[model samples]
Target: MAGGNGLLEVRIAVPAKDASRIARLLVEERLAACAQVVPGMTSTFRWDGEVTTAEEQLILAKTHRSRFEEILDRVGEAHPYETPEIIAVPIVEASAAYAAWLVDEVAAGERP
Candidate 1:
């Protein structure tokens, strides 16, 4: 429908406490076909004027280019970070069945 055979893997880093809620939001809105949350990651970064570290969770959302924008907007609203890390990496390769399934799933919720 909206996207082609092309796919994307969107990565969003969120606070550990909000991980599950964010995952459910993406899947429920169908901005993502699936979202896998990986926790227990120690992230080090510069905040304010000092370097800091915190435990965070990573949300890997499987979707397509068609849904990337929506994912960004929705995650921005749902995320706590002033600037959430939202990155989309093109999926260069995937099994035929899996790719097709991914497109179909994401397309279902896309607006006309």
Candidate 2:
């Protein structure tokens, strides 16, 4: 079993249309233990030398660090953005039960 301390909670921002689709796929593929889709996010940024704003959805994915690259690959293939926003934040602390459950749920039937 992979260690939980190395786990991460990844955040990816995608257009609202693709949030549910990508989130479901990630969880179903076991790349993410759980995915939370937050809608109605307004993003303001500079693009093409002009400031622009757009409505987007945020996907928060929980998974072991060992699967980071795999998660990235999946997101890249599934995302609609030309350069999707993919960011990861390490979980310094988490409920042991939740962490364990996350590992179990994301595994192919393995338990930690």
Candidate 2, position 4, lDDT: 44
Candidate 2 residue-wise lDDT, 1-112, digit = tens: 3344777889999999999999999898898999999999999988889998999999999988778888899899999887889999988788889888887776763325
Each candidate's root-mean-square deviation in Å? 2.7, 3.4
Candidate 2 TM-score versus the reference? 0.88
**Lowest summed lDDT window (length 10), candidate 2:** 103-112
Candidate whose TM-score is highest: 1
TM-score, model 1 to reference? 0.93
lDDT score, residue 94, model 2?
A: 81
lDDT tens per residue, model 1, 22-104: 99999888889899999998899998999989899999999989899899899999999998999998887888888888888
Name the best candidate (by lDDT): 1
Provide TM-scores for the models.
0.93, 0.88
